[model samples]
Target: MLIMATKLNKKLLKTLSAVLFSAVVFVGCNDFFGDKTDLSFIDLPEFTNRDIAYVPIQPAWDQFVYPTDICIGFDELLYVVDEATQQIIGLDESGREQGRFSVPGVTSVTQDRRFDLLACGTLDTVSASGDPITLACIYRIRLLNQNGQYGIRYARIVNKIIHPFYSRSNVNAQDLTVRFGKVAIMASDIPSQNNRYYVTRQGQGGSSILGPNDAVLIFSNTDQFETPISVSTSSGIFNNFFQKPSGIATYAVPPQIQASQERHFFYSSVDPANELKVQFIEYIETDFGAEFRPVIFPVGDTSRADGFLFEPNKFSKPSAIAVAGDNTRFLFVVDEEKDSLFQFTRDGFEGVLPPPATGRTKLEKASFGGTGNGLTQFNRPSGVGYYRRIVYVADSGNGRILRFRLTLDFN
Candidate 1:
């Protein structure tokens, strides 16, 4: 039983070394990300073995010049708004064009349960000198069925929603989201600074860039958008600084084993320093009104923070976050830069939840089929929303909306 004696044979020794090396490599290759991967040494599990799956959706219609935002109608039709074309295109589930509409001055679109849509844009007016600048405007689009297809017939100006003050109100609405009968609007001005009440206060020695920290305006219970309640994310916790809130969704499910309703709001903050941060603000009702406290989640590793970009870059900056219906623990984020999707479990956050298994982890975290060549496959993936078990992605860059089914059983 003297096994060491076998080392005397050169051929056997070489085979033994090869077997050991293969075992080591196999042990190191257990990854759970996606079709694309990033880390050099990290080899992902082959897609076939893993329970995860993806179906590429092709556009049924022509591509928009530069699609930016998207939303799904209650009827299950997908609507896309293109910034370059200044037009709204509709597509069926199969990716074919169902209908289309045009606007004079519109930039983005968001839809609600009422089958009403919110169109955001900057109203441009010429000065006496003939130079053009933008003023903020939001239009509520009412859709009607014309010959078995959806059509946009009437648009109304949503003046005076949540923020009632409106002194020199030049906030250009960027994103619109509606939940629990409340429509949320986000906007900023010239310096891209946000303030509670933006006031220049004539001759008070104001800074050229001074304004209320960025604002989140909430419009509630009115198709007219007349009665608005404004909520500000600025507080001492923000410590007299500024944070920009983008892509908001409301979480209003009943607290488990509790009597009261839980109203939680989730948003992405693209602060230059903390561009990878996602903030969760909870609203607890008090005698006066709603109270705001922000819980911040720093994305990726803080060590490589410099790579984080507020503006679109090669690596994705978490642009939008949405909660899947069945499990609040399942959260999805769309990276506008990489034009990909990332899924994280509740435990994935360093909070009360336990860490999710490798199978239930981040996807699209790296280069697939090698380097820059693979990105051309994606256009500009934007906003994500859900209806029942189905997930909808606004394939903005591709000029179509892709539908997918959410599943688990990662091998």
Candidate 2:
């Protein structure tokens, strides 16, 4: 045991060094989030594509030209929004066309807790003083029942702020989500300059160019715009301001845990960017007013102050996101560019941030579908909704709606 050790050969030394380096790299890549467990090796349940329903598009009559969004009503019926046709078509559980309502220049649709369908779009109308103005507004439609007939009535309109100087409203409503009797509308070109809204004049006259502050405008259940929550990228906290806030999904906290939580609402956003990232924000109520606090969830080896997940190469133009109702255990995101749906689970991460990784929250589980027109594929899928363990996808490019069910493994 006291004998002098033999000098190692140069080749052997190099081999040992290479082996150590490889081991370090492997550990660094796999356990970047300071977790001992490897997420790639975690066994999770897979999502199976059960059925696909195509909306009839023909020469005589076209039901859906470019379906952009979808919502699940209180009655469990599916409402699909078509941008090209400017209509929200209702489909039964079996994917049959039940009824359709026209909403001109429609961009997004959602059903409130009262079973009233809320449609967000642009409309041409006169201002309060009778001036011609184009405005972005939300229309609430009530479901009527008479003689076994599915009659729909246009109830009221919640008009967004329109600048008196400009002919059209500066706000460009992208998406809307209703939760806890509150409506959150994602918009761009928010009035910020000296509390005034301005837009750059294109073409021959283009000098008055004023930038806008993108925001999430809050509205009450009575269809009134309350205040605008501006999302700023200037602070070192946020990675960037939302360029194109496409879709939003809200999660309501359960009653049992509501007392202990300062943040009641958990919302996710899908912004179209070069590197698609999913932004998570918690709706916190402060003494001043309601605030949207960005949650910095750990993803891979880094911690993002603005987003929970970041995979630019994998996500190509993510359009929409949906979380399990009341249960934040599962989440789904629709990638329009890749034409696929990504599933995430709250297995390894914490539910809340700041005190990060204290409790199990959610992480990416698996992904399914691809770019195609087949039954098991998607073409530029836009909106996604989860209800009663079933996921409904608005396959915009293919003019259809695809549904899938979650297959959980107790073992």
Over the full model, what C-alpha lDDT does candidate 1 score relative to the true structure?
Answer: 0.45
TM-scores for every candidate against the unseen true structure: 0.57, 0.59
Candidate 2 ranges beyond 4 A from true positions: 1-63, 125-134, 145-213, 231-240, 252-276, 286-290, 301-308, 311-314, 326-328, 346-364, 409-411
lDDT of 2: 0.51
lDDT, model 2, position 103 = 70
lDDT tens digits by residue: candidate 2, 1-411: 001111223455577678666755667754564644344553323223321111222111125778878777655677788888888788766666776778757767776544566676666776556666565455666775444444343333433322222222332222111111113222222222111111111111111222222334455555544444444333643323444455555542111222122222233334444463566666556687755565654555434222235444446667777666545456677888888777654322312221123242322234567788765578898878776666778888888777665323101
Which candidate has the highest lDDT of all? Answer: 2
lDDT of 1 by residue, 216-296 (tens): 444433422221223346543332232444465543211112111244556554445554455556656778766556654
Q: Tell me, what's the RMSD of every candidate?
A: 13.4, 16.8
